[model samples]
Target: EEHPDNPGARLFLGLTLAQVGDLDGASREYKESARLAPDDPFPHYFHGQALHTLDRLDMAIREYREAVKLAPQDVRMRLNLGSAYYEQGIFESAIAQYREALKLNPGDAYIHYNLGLALADQGRFEPAIAAYKESARLNPTDPLVRYALGVVQETKGRVNEAIGEFEAAAQLAPTMAAAHAKLGWLYYNKNQVPQALEHFEKASRHDPDDAQTLHGLGLAKLASGKKDEGILSLKQAYQKEEREDKKRLIRSVLVKVGALSH
Candidate 1:
């Protein structure tokens, strides 16, 4: 009560509350701090952080915008604002903020990766590929960058290139279930049953609940003449699959194998 007019005191209280995981208390203190010192950007910035942590992206974006207005040259604020916009599906706004952040800190691999994600969300695959490439160049050991590059290549119908990227990603991060699953899928499409089986088994080992991996494993088993095992795997995949198209595909296979009535 004695420090009613003290913005710094309120700000300090907010920080303490945040440190103790009292998000609602921290938020109230931050609001009071901002009210006491409307010109100070720190309160708004901290408020944005709290909101973002709570997954209140709309409110976070608004607070971040206020912080940006108060400190336009702050690169970290721009990045945070861009991330908030990305979370809200405002890809163009995110791109603009990411571009500005890149100009301020060109060597930031995460900024490039985020720019790629925004461009990908807009379906601008060509530029998205370039951004992901730059991010991979800057951060070579990052398996997610390699995986994203693989996905874009696949989307562009460059199956061979996508296979290469997925292979590298799988090698770099052996436990990455998605990379192994992608490799299995590509091999299956190429009619390389043995190779597909190898990757599918690895993928299933990493994520036993993955329907797509189970589907691939079933097909590869059938191709290798393991009819009973293949039927079991297909049944499991059908049970686990939630997507309509995938379920239809699994049904078609079950019918072809005489496991289901036509």
Candidate 2:
């Protein structure tokens, strides 16, 4: 209730709403803050954060860029800008911004994680692994980073190491669907079909609507000699899936199991 025209108070109100996960309210406050003082950068920066939370990636990018222009020396803004680019599928641009931020804050674990994602998108497996390793070193408690590293390790054919990372990730974050899925895949690749099925079941249980987990469960069942049940689950996953890529994943599972029928 500071003066209605106080840009700083409006900015703080916007940021407070953002911290509480009220994206729309935060955006409204930020809009008012921006209008109150167009020269101030905090409103625009937090506005970008609110828009990003709402999945308005393009608008978030524009706002973040404006924030960067207003406060060109703020490395954190550059990092936020990089993440916005990453979410929008601009990997190279994301990397560029992240590295710039890194120049200003070399030890930021989140930057390492974001850099790893950009590198992985480019198929630069070695660099991605290095980046992920650095992030894991810097932030050992973050299960999401561990899970991402495990998935990348699996993609690079390091099955045993991947399994270790996935199991650790699962232990740290029991609710992480991706860790369960990766662990299941790791077990499957090691010829431990029963173990694979157990993990797949866990993954699917945690995220029932995840078609990939369902398909994974189906694959594990098939590999363990339950073809009929496997095919049924695969068929369900195929029908329930929404994205084209996930549909393709279901089809691949079906092919591996030798059918796509009722």
Candidate 3:
């Protein structure tokens, strides 16, 4: 307590508080440290982490940016900044930070995963696929990476490749509903009604509130030409669809089937 504003002591205290989930106290320590040592990035980096823990994304982003500016070669600082931007939904900024970090640590699986996420956030499916594939290759046992790769494949219209990645993700993470749903959608597109139905059902069972899988199930039922069952499934899908794209797809299908007025 001799010098509460001492940057080193404050940094350690802030870190301890952050580790124990006392974000408010951590922020206070970080602020005092930064005030005393504005030129140093340690306080700013710690402040950013504390702010992130408190869900103050905008402030967190600002602090991380300060750390990156002060410590340009510190790969961890850039990575932290990128993660903060991602939380703020600033995809371009996130990608820039991640790319900068990649230049410092090109072989890092975590960095590649971050790059993939940034690309995916901007809907850059092709680059996302490449980044995610690299992440998966670097960390083959990482279920999350496999799941991310599956998503990139799906987004890129590589349905068969997506299926393979999804299957790998499912094998690695049986509980991930998105992978199951993606596989279900791919099977539906391929006209494999039974397999599509099975994956959809699995997806629904894993995450009951997932409207996409339920909607896909409806389409699969229709693909099988069972009018009554298909109509019921479609009705459920229509009732629960929240995404604009899903709703549009449902509308187009309904119009073609004379179920909804175009």
**Candidate with maximal lDDT:** 1
lDDT of each: 0.94, 0.87, 0.85
Which candidate gets the maximum TM-score versus the true structure? 1
Kindly report which residue pairs in candidate 1 clash with one another.
none
Tens digit of lDDT per residue, candidate 3, span 1-262?
A: 8677578888888889888889999899989888888899999998988888778999998899899899999999899888888888899999999999989988899999989988988999889888988888888888888888877777777888878988998888888888889889888888889999888878888987777777887788787776667666677777788888888887787777888787
RMSD of every prediction: 1.5, 4.7, 3.6
Query: Residue 143's C-alpha lDDT in candidate 1?
Result: 92
Choose 1 or 3, whichever is better by lDDT: 1
- What 10-residue stretch in candidate 1 is worst by lDDT? 1-10
Which parts of model 1 are misplaced by more than 4 Å? none
Candidate 1 on 1-262: residue-level lDDT in tens?
A: 6688899999999999999999889999999999989999999999999999999999999999999899988888999999999999999999999999999888989999999999998999999999999999999999999999999999999999999999989989999999999999999999998999999999999999999899999999999899999999999999999999999999999999999999
True-vs-predicted CA distance for residue 143, candidate 1, Å: 0.5
Q: Supply candidate 2's per-residue lDDT for 119.
A: 96
RMSD of 1: 1.5
Q: Model 2 off-target regions past 4 Å?
A: 1-39, 50-59, 209-211, 222-262
Model 3 global lDDT (CA atoms, 0 to 1)? 0.85
Rank all candidate structures by their TM-score, best first, as comma-separated numbers: 1, 3, 2
Error of 1 at 136 (Å): 0.4
